[model samples]
Target: MSARARERPGQHDVAHPAWTLVMSVAASSLSFIDGSILNVALPAIRADTGAGAAEVQWVVNAYTLPLAALILLGGALGDHQGRRRWLVIGTVLFGIASLVCALAGSLQTLLAGRALQGVGAALLLPNSLALLNGAYSGEARGQAVGTWAAAGAISAAIAPLAGGWLVQQFGWPSIFYVNIPFVGVAIVIALTRVEEVSDPGSARLDLGGAALATLGLGAATYGLTLWSQTFALSTLAGGAIAAGLALLVAFGLYERRLGDKAMVPLSLFGNRCFTSLNLMTFLLYGAFGGAMLLIPFTLIEAGGYSPVEAGLALLPLSILIGGASRMMGKLAEKIGPRWPLTIGPIIVGIGLALASRLAESQSYWTHAFPAILVMSTGMALAVAPLTSTVLASVSRHQTGMASGLNSALSRLGGLIIVALLGAVLVAQGDALLRPFAMALRMMGVVAALGGVAAFFGLSGNWRHADSGTETV
Candidate 1:
């Protein structure tokens, strides 16, 4: 790509920046909200469906697994086909899946619905991001991404509270039902407002690679989920893990053969900055996921708080992330991303350590708020810069794939950590509080390691990425 093209490619084509931002951000928010909305509702769902600990974890994992698995294909498809078309199809599919979830009669049925919801999310998220990347350029692009991240964080933050209120006023199913109208609005706006964007020069669809990825991730996640039930190494889980690993290995080798035609270009991983950023993403997001999974359970089951109270406890986290994201994005631009990325996760680790104190006391002010605030602050400092770095690391054509891969790794981290924690939760039983504290401490350690990785991995001059070229 030409230097001018690399720097200012998006500036020339964008027709409706404001509307594009609104629709893309809204569409993406549905996926974000869906990701976390079930956290507060998990207890209620368990009560309603007689789901055990393992099943409850499946309720979360069912959504995350496919999302992590197929997201690359989703991005590739959007780039090969059309972003707006896939966005609309994904929105519609998500709405339909939400309805199925709302009407599910059993835990099995709900898990099925959640899995389908994840498929829609895989289709939605990467394309929405690609649309955003296509709509703006340079500093405006950074600001747009910051705004998008803030909106997503706020939506994620509101999910638990909104879900709690819905469960209290109506029922647990109401959370799923409520998504219909919002999905409708998002679809209408997406069709009418967002411009069509796709790469005419993109490679053909990589169906074989997509299938391999799906099978590999599904098998691995299933193995982890089943392993969580026994804590001990079971033969079935062992086989599944081995099979999953083999399949992933096969997929990697196959992609290497395909070269640039691959769904995820192998060349992108050659960038040291890209690889490091994604590594940081995995560790930090995994810690965040494990901590989030525990919070509602700790509050409602052990701390004796109602669902509403549990949901409300996180409201300040939303506000802090939303308020601080743009400023931090600007800060990252001014001073570069290394220090903020390195320091931010360390602060988050401190926050998780503070949150571990919650196991001893249910005092919202003394125990919950401070820890949540600190974590939120750290996230605010990191998220936008993280996104900016990922996008900048690749060429314009690779935006969708880069975003999808980063998102997948991040979700995969969460998926693994949450499943592992679920096993611990089941083993602890009545002693939920102690295990919860221990899990927080473990998450803190993981997050601190992410900070350490960022410190060593990222460069002071990372803002200006290398020109997109085949490098090894």
Candidate 2:
């Protein structure tokens, strides 16, 4: 091994961890920006392609299902093959996928391209995080995670504004083409700066487990998404959901049989802290996703705001989250994650409760801005510490899978909740005001419960940044 490559955990042996941070952040932005921007492009896509609602939904779902389904396997692949290697490969594939999306002649072609992009994203997200976990240690790792979170927030925040401008000036295809430059930058950085790392213990690929996971998650996600469109249980949706559940059960059993050789080491869930952390992730992210979906529609459809205005309403939130995340990471480093994790979600709940007050004819300053500030502040407090705790809960060697599972939970939470909440939207129909309020309040309840989980479940010492290597 090279001298720098031999550096032990908790040591900043690399000449510039900053470069690693930059590369990872850049790599991650490729997905975050693309995901966020596409929402804005959807109307344009519909206009250009004359696609139906189902096709548009497919355009979005095609990307998300694969991303959520394959992320764990992607992490396992990274751990077994090599993080930097996969990063490079994923970046190239993402660029190619973006190019395909840009040039897509029809809805079906676009959906195919989007699915390919999701595959690239699945490979990129967890490994980017794992690279950070392996590169930084102690307080620095917390800061790096904070920065990574901030970069993601900023990328997501910028997407709407940039996508709108690009779509207006050039075309909807510009959104996909926009990713090309970012992908190029990410690839160059990865090849030049990021170091390769892999777990020898992860040499074996659990192909059966992977296939089962992909099929299960894909079926469940499709069923859930379809369920929203038709509030009643259609035969196809019901069968898909049932089949998905069964396959997932089989996947779990298969993984258990594999023991340590499993793609997702079931033993990781055996750690109380890890389990609690993921449970918290699922609840909080689900709530976050559901509430966010309602907010933009409420503003645009109910409050009579323009689409651009509705998009800008969230600008402050991104800034708050990006700004406050690093400071909160430092706080978690100083005091431990217990208070921040517990208190942060409670505050988020409170903010969401306030958001429930939003209605037609309300001023943006009075109604939306205040809620955004409070919720973003609370979110900023929680995000970094949550990431740190998840990483700290597992051993260094397993960081990729740990990060992958956490990442997958986050995506899955959003996917499932969005689908479920769509039913409420459909049921309410023209009278969306009441449903919107209920969604916000429901999210608030979920957030508060996450705080409860953190308070009772996360051990105090491990919540601290200096917890060392106890492996929970």
Candidate 3:
């Protein structure tokens, strides 16, 4: 008859006596593949659109922006509605978007479709983790998450190679078209293996908070992109930068008035370990995201390699990143997550900084491979621990939201880094490229900035993340 007793029954119902680890991992992998696949298609996309650099940049930015800004909201939405229903809906929408992208006749249409796909991705990512949390408990939860992370790690490794081949053999459309078969398989598996669950009570959507957050993030990302045009502030760029900062501040005040979607649970910020861990995720992922953006082009523009060749150059690192993620997950449980997370990015950043110093006259093995290899080593070492640390920091109830936010922040880091770094390279290339030295130098600076954040921000005991907090 008591209020606390009534709440306990509903919360208890969310727990799982039977968990489906394979289903969770498979669902998570599909989400990861969707993200990594498009990157290899960017060059082919440039040729097909007849759009210049700035316009072509939108193809990547369009998907990344909505995906980043809305991921937390997506997680919260799932908690309010039915996570399974949302997951199925998300998968279907992604398929529709992928089809639209495949058939798009104009650049605008393709970008719109990519945005839809991003929305679907954001929807699916967090709910999948939330479902996983509901199914498993304690150490079983760790193993299930490890499986999910590993599956995603594998997909990230393979997407580049697969996407490159698809682009070369069939053309760019094949990249989008490939997603259709995946959608069917995922839907069938999810329907059969996953149980449906939703909150019986309703929660407010917080439209005002959502709008400010979206506009703020969008403006900030856009302004930084303008800066990439010429690190110096032109009249237009300066104006945009001012506008973005103003909007971002407005977003913060708005969120304070309302609340984060069920996913972020703003109170998590009160946990220093949680906040710091997220930053570490952002920094490491930014480096990872920026590398994905630049490395493909390096092989294509500088090395005379096809898209497939670029993917091939990345295989070593991709494989390593996955392996390292698995290793870090286990290690985090042992030595603690902070050490690896800190050390990994520093190593990767050093490699990137070294890469910035590379000579055009040098070959991949001599000039490029060293930095690439070192960066991969650092990345491989860091991902699992950083991810594990975040998951460990949060309450069981919000695991899905936490997972989604982790993924989103990583993508946001990439989305912004690529926008800025790519812009810088393009704007400066003409002026600096007669020598090729300056381009490399710029990359090193970018890499060093990422490393510095990882080192300073990753100072905490992720192992003892106060797991006693009650799940809301």
Best candidate according to TM-score: 1
User: Model 2, 1-472: lDDT tens per residue?
Assistant: 4322332333334437787898888889998888677765665676689865456556766787778878877776777778777877888888999999999898888989998998999888877877887889998996797678778898989887787678767888988988888788877766666677887555547789878988998888778767866567899989999999999999999999999888777998877778888888888887886666667656655666655666688778777888887788788888778889888888888889988888778888998999999899889888867865787877766665676678888877776776666544443224767777877888899988888888877765443244344422
Can you give the TM-score per candidate against the true fold? 0.90, 0.85, 0.84
Those runs of model 3 whose alpha carbons end farther than 4 Å from true positions after fitting are 1-26, 200-204, 232-236, 259-267, 357-362, 392-403, 422-465, 468-472
Top-down TM-score ranking: 1, 2, 3
Error of 3 at 349 (Å): 0.5
Residues 194-224 of candidate 1: C-alpha lDDT, one tens digit per residue:
6777764663478888889889877887787
- Lowest-lDDT window of 10 residues in candidate 1? 2-11
lDDT score, candidate 1, position 274: 80
In model 2, residue pairs whose N, Cα or C atoms come closer than 3 Å (at least 3 residues apart or on different chains), thus clashing, are none
Between candidates 1 and 2, which one is better according to TM-score? 1
Which of the two candidates, 1 or 3, achieves a greater TM-score against the reference?
A: 1
Question: Against the true structure, candidate 1 has what lDDT?
Answer: 0.80
- Candidate 2 regions off by >4 Å? 1-21, 43-57, 131-147, 192-196, 333-335, 357-361, 395-397, 424-432, 459-472
For candidate 2, the per-residue lDDT at 177 reads 87
